[model samples]
Target: MSGRKTGALLVLVLLALLGACSPAPECSSHQDCPPGQLCLSNRCQPGSPADGAADAGADPGRDAGADPGSDGADAGADPAGDAGADAGADAGADTGADPGADAAGDTGADAGDEAADSGPGDCLDPDGDGYGTGTSCLGPDCAPDDAERHPGAPELCNGLDDDCDGVPDQGGVCPQANPYLWVFLLAGQSNMVGLGVNSELGGADASGVNNVHIFCDLSVHNDGNPHCLHWVTPLVPGFGVLPDRFGPELSFGRRLHELWPNRSLAIIKIAEGGTALADRWAARDGDLYQLLVQQVTTQMNDLHIAWSPRLVAFVWMQGESDACSSDTANAYYLNLRNFIQALRQDLGVDLLPITAGLIADQPMWPEAGKVRDATSLLADHLGPMDVVETTDLPRHPDDLAHYDTAGQLELGRRFAEAVNALLADRDWEFPGDFSRAQGDGFWRYQACQGASCSLLSWDLFRRYWKNASATVLIGDGWVQPAESQAAEISWWAPWDGRIQVTASAVLAASGGDGTMVSIFRNERLLAGPRPLTAGSGASFDLLLDVEQGQRLRFITDSGSTADGELDRTTWQITVHMSRVAGD
Candidate 1:
């Protein structure tokens, strides 16, 4: 047969097949059909190939055995038409098409609809913690059980990272109240009340001056006493009673302000002149103590109202009046302890850091030695306590007792140092060499003759004990020890370091017996046992490495029983210990 005739016959057969198999119009492409119809296998379909086949097969004219508009297919025809319709519907649904659509459409809502039906893992955050749990979702929450535990949560001190930013307690606990500032409590007597002449502070320069706010409530005293419970920038002369006097607060506030420029400094000064710890500043019974507590509470409330502040430390500098009497001086330790405990109780914090200045030596006050002893005892026994020494500080020429302007300035600097050390959790040590003059003067001593030892206080030895066998007396700038007696002085080592100890004294033996002077480190002999004879002077210089908390002992032993003696003429005994090196 010819090629043209064969092609015409094939086209006629295809047209016949289309007319019988499909009820839709016949076309070469999809554009030839109605607006929504698509051409498939030369048939104009309503949707796609699968949709047209299903609809065409459902017609009773095309399938003789099948009912019109019925879902069932003809018995003799392939069952794939119904299967193809089911597959097309599933594909449309999986691809985010409307379920009612005949075939898979171009809409992207299928996955979203499935996620909405499944719940939680979708973009929906049920916990409201700004995080989602599903792997396919936008925000994946690692821990959905705890609402507090989420991405970008705040880290607190409760041993948990509330905001899951991969750090635990990074920023510390958030303050419950705002306007947080640092507070300092200034208490005690005269020196604390600005006994120093204000004119002396002319040369002292405080770097950051504007950050300090002092709250003074001298209402208990006369109106002229700078009594106001309002915040004011600290000024030298105004901080005290008279405009010409100033206390340690000026330098203290200035230094603190300089150290923490970003933080606000608040000083609550509650001090008065000539107040003794036994009476005026007594913990429970004293009027001043009660008044101090009241003022602190009232001012603290006012401070909170104005600007919330955190109470950091308490600075105390009293006890001069106690130095005037033996009874008050003796009880200074207990009185100071009670006052501190009461202050902490009133403030509601038991472990408040207390930095106190030791009472300076008063030539007119005979019992000053006792007060000094009590102050040392307090520093040694109390926790979170620091003592700044003022024994060597020069007194103001005018008052003859109060610290001079230079002394007050130095005292204020020391107070700041001690407070700063407390905040940093470190020890504050007095610089320079420590010297104990008069042998039995600055130290507590116990003398023994053949295992019988008696503790001789610093005051008693200065008063009596010239004839006793174990008596050691300091007179005319000399130390005199009787026969067969050993005098020992012990103190706590301030720092861990190598110390150079030097001791010198003139000695004389009654029956030609030699005398020996020794230095011991916690009972272990480090230097001395140097022999002494009549008209011979004993002297020893030794270097020893020591640690803090170690006890050091300096002892003088008369070698012969009832026969040896130390000369009183040119007989000064001095023990000086200086830190040479180490830390």
Candidate 2:
């Protein structure tokens, strides 16, 4: 036990003291702890109360030793209180026991994972408008309750955005402005029924023009045709009473389709043969006029089912029968006016333009000229009326009254020209020089036995020409003019010019010595003081210089016969005026 023995003993004592002062082994799990011990604050400690207190002071990582009466873990809360609170108290407080700390920590980690699993930006949407509520989600809805109040929806006339494009009712999805079909009404007599043979022109194919439609009033035929009272499309040859015949409508519709290829064009045609304006086709009730109205409205309703219809114009081509009788011819102008007015009223289009086709003159119809004159007067009376001359159109080979196929084709093209002029708001100029004098400066006169010579104005003349009597006597006795046999007419010159004024009169006498007929302008002699015998007719023309606003007058004189028998003589007179060239 010298120096070496003493050094070894000292070393052993120091090692023992160091071991006693050292910290307990740390653990993160129960498996990391010794047998019968628990892991707490990453350290292995005793499970029993006595052992727990003994080891608590033995490990400096824990608090100083607790008294036997106090709980060992609670006593460890004194020194290093925060450490004890976090490790011992808090762990136990979280799990209700120290052993349950790991379970509590694992439960907290599971809760965090659950919160992460649920989408962070996912928002609650109470309303199902394809858009979400709350600021946290994509496609945030401005209004959640209204389905129509969403984005990218159609905007309607309603105050809201139906199409949900930021702007309302102004974009591509907005309602169309004018969704209407342009409509035309074709009505009149045999000409309107289209007597031109369809085979002559090889017919037209309206089927190729998909937008043009037509509804013919076959009810007037009373033939039990299926399309009689219904609307039909693609106007073709069989529209008239005769299957081989067609009217101006075929070409007219084709031209219209060419003009408006994108829009729907509908034509409602109601016409019949031998219809006179004075009787069956008169504007008054109980006539074919009401039937025309009914047909038009019925077709309009049918058209409206697919698209709204706008009545653009009315085309009238008739008057042949009216020209057969002098009475009807005389009343033609007034009858036409009434018909147009009534038509406008019934159709609810006050300014509806009427394109009338003047009846052609026929040798069989002597009074046809009178009807033509009345039509001219009709044009003068109505502002929106236009007259298309058919006198120059070639007549059918078999029939003298109706137009031939080529003429009918031209007539249809003319009708289209007129319609286009009207729709384009352009002025329509008539074909000849007579068009300038249409409103005035033309007159027709007839005088009969025992009747006072009547000085009728244009309007009056058209109404009462037939009732005014005039008998033409053509053989050998002495004859005299009717009482007050002279009639006169006057008109103001529209421009300063030399106008060619012409007057013609047909005279008849029964064995008259002679009769003197005369014509004058502004009380100055212009024509005849010419003397003639029985059964004579003559014409006179004068070129006279006239100033603007100057008035001209026409006069006729017939001398007395030996017997004073005025009934034996009568006369008819016609006067025409035209502006001279280089005026």
Candidate 3:
């Protein structure tokens, strides 16, 4: 037979087999049957493919069964059909060997096919931690032990790798360290959490600073240690620590670095949005204060962060929270004083200076006089403390609180100013302001061995002169006393220089134990202390051409500590230096 005839016969055989397997049509309803088939009840009945005619009494299945081609017997029936039928029968006999083993009729594939389908013997290996021997389709690979899944254990607070092997919080558990680190605890309420923006601070081109790391609590009362930080009043306008972001501009510390240019700083911020001083930070006995303590302690412990070098200052930007509270402005001052004292105790610093942000001038705090008075009282009462006035900065519309990015940055700068001022005070040696000092040199006053008081080193100081707090005494009791011997020293302007030195101080001691001021040039005592009079500080200026290398010191001969305040002294000195040539 020609190949074409064989192909046609094979196609015919397939059609017959498919026709035999189809279900008999049932007639249920009129729509169930072909248009020509009448629905006796509700079943669909068979009909001709076209014209809606019924092929009555025709049987395709039976036709195929009776033909010699159907039983695989006729030579003209198509050998391909015969071959397929033989293959089916052979497959039935084995029930396992595949019929597609090979079209070329080779059984070599039998062993390979069996091997390819075989699974491991019985040994569990789930995560492929390697040494398992198993034989089951669902054996080791699909076993629970073979996989490392994130089950999200409940031991998030223990700070341990709770789930067995090596890592903690691996499976939906808390991460060994949350990727969202560098958190700033946002307390208070809307202000600290943020009231958002009227417009972008630096416009679309403005990029936010990450210096003030921010984190937040899940809810206001959430006990979970939040890793988010929310800034109080941002330094730059847009620099507040938000939900999952920080903005406005740079933070106080960032600006601090800019001003100092040589200091390392970190910010552990925690400002509440709508918190009040009396409510949020009352005392440890108070609910809000306790909450703050817990947060601060937990963060420090969990992250093992030490508050030093890094913890340069505490920024308190709260009065608004307490503005309308029962704590009157005076009470606010009292509470703030206690809070400051508590913070110092907790932080283990004798004088942890704080920079308090004053309520900006606006409608919310229209008459900020109270706020100012309260803050001023706190600053004055609190030792080594200062204030960052918001009076000069722009305020939000509500004016009750908050600022735009520019206002925020200015606030940050002010905060930084307070801090730098504190630092500068601590250094305490500059004659005038740091901004205007002559030749980068310091006038070191050394009271080494009684009568030898003198201006010594600038870059280095001997152990005896290393006392950063070098105060001069006038009298036996901080005033001129009878028969008291006062030590004085001085250094002449290297050239014919005019020094503008201003001294304003109070003599806390009694009697002849008073201080004296003097100037010396080339071994010639040009002038002597016109007595820094009792109870009042004195100032003196003498236009004398103290040549280079001239020496100066205070000399007193009328007071004795034998019957007066021992070491009765403390004089605050501030001196300004400039070239006579006026460069």
Compared with the true structure, all predictions reach lDDT values of 0.54, 0.52, 0.39
Query: Candidate 3: deviation at residue 26, Å?
Result: 99
How would you encode candidate 2's per-residue C-alpha lDDT over 161-258 as one tens digit per residue? 33334332344422343355778888888777776665566534433346777788744563634444555666665566665667788778888777
Among the numbered candidates, top TM-score falls to 1
Where model 3 places Cα greater than 4 Å from the true spot, the runs are 1-190, 196-199, 203-205, 208-250, 260-262, 301-310, 325-327, 362-367, 398-400, 429-562, 565-583
Positional deviation of 302 in candidate 3, in angstroms?
5.3
Model 3 — which ten-residue stretch has the worst lDDT? Answer: 102-111
TM-score, ranked from best to worst: 1, 2, 3
**Structural similarity to truth (TM-score) of each candidate:** 0.46, 0.44, 0.40
Candidate 1 lDDT score at position 532: 61
lDDT (10s digit) by residue, model 1, range 1-583:
8999999999999999987876677764344677667555456655743343233222211212322112222121111111221122222211111121111101101011112343533343323333444442335433332233355543333222335553333463423324556788998777787766655555444222677788765534436555345667754346666656667888888878766667777888887777788988888789888888888778777776766455668998887789888888889889888888777766654446788887777677788778877877776555567788987887777677777777777787889988877664222211111122211112334565543555554344444333343356433334455665565554433323344444555564345465665554433333445556676665444333333334445566655553423333222333233431111
Please identify model 1 stretches exceeding 4 Å from their true place: 1-160, 167-177, 203-208, 218-222, 227-229, 234-236, 426-583
In terms of lDDT, the poorest run of 10 residues in model 2 is 103-112
Model 1 poorest 10 in a row by lDDT: 103-112
Which residue ranges in model 2 land beyond 4 Å of their true spot? 1-178, 203-208, 219-227, 426-583
